[model samples]
Target: MAIKAVENKFKKFFYSRLSLFLLLLAVIWLSLVLVKTFYRRHQLDNEISSLKGEIDKLEKKHQELDQLISYVGSQDFLEKEAKDKLNLKKEGENVAMINESALGREVAGEAATTTSAQNPAGSNNENKLIQWWKFFFSR
Candidate 1:
């Protein structure tokens, strides 16, 4: 009878220890799963917030482009373009165009005469390459 009671006690002790180990393992696995889920949720939230900010910027840009498009399509913009590019003018409006090349030539001739008068000896001493360079690029 003493030996039977000892065997039964051993069995009960072993089962209790096994059950405790299994419960501990299950708790650890559940904790790991919860931690991983929280990390994933945090990553997704950060991505969502960044995307929302990008969307807002894009919306603002879109609005600005729409305004620019409307302005470009207006009649005032068309008239301005015609006057500036095509030289078109309204009736009774005087349009004066300056002759730039003729004015430039007159100014350039005076400059060349003054430069030559100031340094006649220096001008003569210059090489052919220097002379050609001055002729093409002086003005």
Candidate 2:
């Protein structure tokens, strides 16, 4: 008797147009919620993967910086810097210095030759008057 009554109630609920419409709406709402949840989960997963990649890159950079620091602190690097920047050498070691001004003049001479080849008249004109501004202001 109890089973029959439950079955009757189920049939009545299923047959009602209002109840069926409400049921369909509930189903649609639940599906939309599920889709939203899945999309958010996917977004979070991508963010996590990118963050992990960034961490790996940072770790590699840190290792490179540590190696550079160790190398810079060594005696070899110090000796090299001193020799290059300070022009220091051990006793009895001959240091041959190149004349920087002469090398510069050579380069300037080549550039002047090329410009004269391109425009001979223009070169002569520009060269003469170029020093007039500096000449007039000189003490």
Candidate 3:
């Protein structure tokens, strides 16, 4: 009777279907967790690669801007800008003003004619004074 009881216990310990099913479920769960971890790691690596690329592009742009700033700050560039914009010249150089005769003739034709006899000198001065007052008050 003692030998039979020991043999039945050993058989139950080794051949229980529920225990086997639980072991299999644990292995499957572990495999799923490992797969999810690996996938997330791969996604993060791709994001890092893209961020590195963006950093490289910004670095190149920064280098270009630095060069441009250096050039603009140079005396040569300043002289060119001054000559073009302000029409500056060296000492002993004569500055000539080009006449726009055609444009002046067109403007002369469009000018209003107001005679002092019709408008009166006092009225014109009064109009100017009133305009100045209105401008100052409006501002």
Candidate 4:
């Protein structure tokens, strides 16, 4: 008798349209939630990977800067830089002075020759001025 009553209740519950519709809605809602969570997790993982790459790049740059600092602190590197940039000389060393105009003329002559060879018609007038500006600004 008890088994038969339970079986009747199960049959009624299974046939109810409201119960069936609620079960379907629950499944669909859960699926949507899971998909959204998965997509968000993937996006966060990509962001983490990008940040890790940036960290590696920064670490490499820091190492390079440390090496440069050590090199600059050395006596040999300082002496070489001083000699090249400041024209420093040791005892018994003779320094030579060359004319700036002559160097400029040589460079200008070479540039004119190259320009004529490359472009027979003519180059943009603003190109040289822009290049000079860029060189000055970049330095």
lDDT of candidate 4 at residue 130, scale 0 to 100? 82
User: Whose lDDT is greatest here?
Assistant: 2
Give lDDT tens digits, candidate 2, residues 2-116: 9999999999999999899999999999999999999999999999999999999999999999999999999999989999999899889998888999999999999988977
Score every model by TM-score: 0.63, 0.67, 0.57, 0.64
Error of 4 at 95 (Å): 2.5
Q: Give each model's clash number.
A: 0, 0, 0, 0
lDDT per residue for candidate 3 within 19-130, as digits (tens), equals 7898899999999999999999999999999999999999999999999999999999998898779999768878777568977976676563434346778988898899
What's the residue-level lDDT of 78 in candidate 1? 95
**Candidate 4 lDDT, 1-139, residue by residue in tens:** 9999999999889889988998999999999999999999999999999999999999999999999999999999988998989989889988898889999999999998897678634365467778889999987
- Winner of 2 and 3 under TM-score: 2
lDDT of 4 at 138: 86
TM-score of 1: 0.63
Clashes of 4: 0
Question: In model 2, how large is the Cα lDDT of residue 17?
Answer: 97
Report every candidate's CA lDDT. 0.91, 0.93, 0.88, 0.91
Model 1 over residues 1-139: C-alpha lDDT tens digits? 9999999998887679787898799999999999999999999999999999999999999999999999999999999999999999999999888899999999999998797678767556675569799999999
Q: Is candidate 2 or candidate 4 better by TM-score?
A: 2
Q: After superposition, how far is residue 26 of candidate 3 from its true place, in Å?
A: 0.8
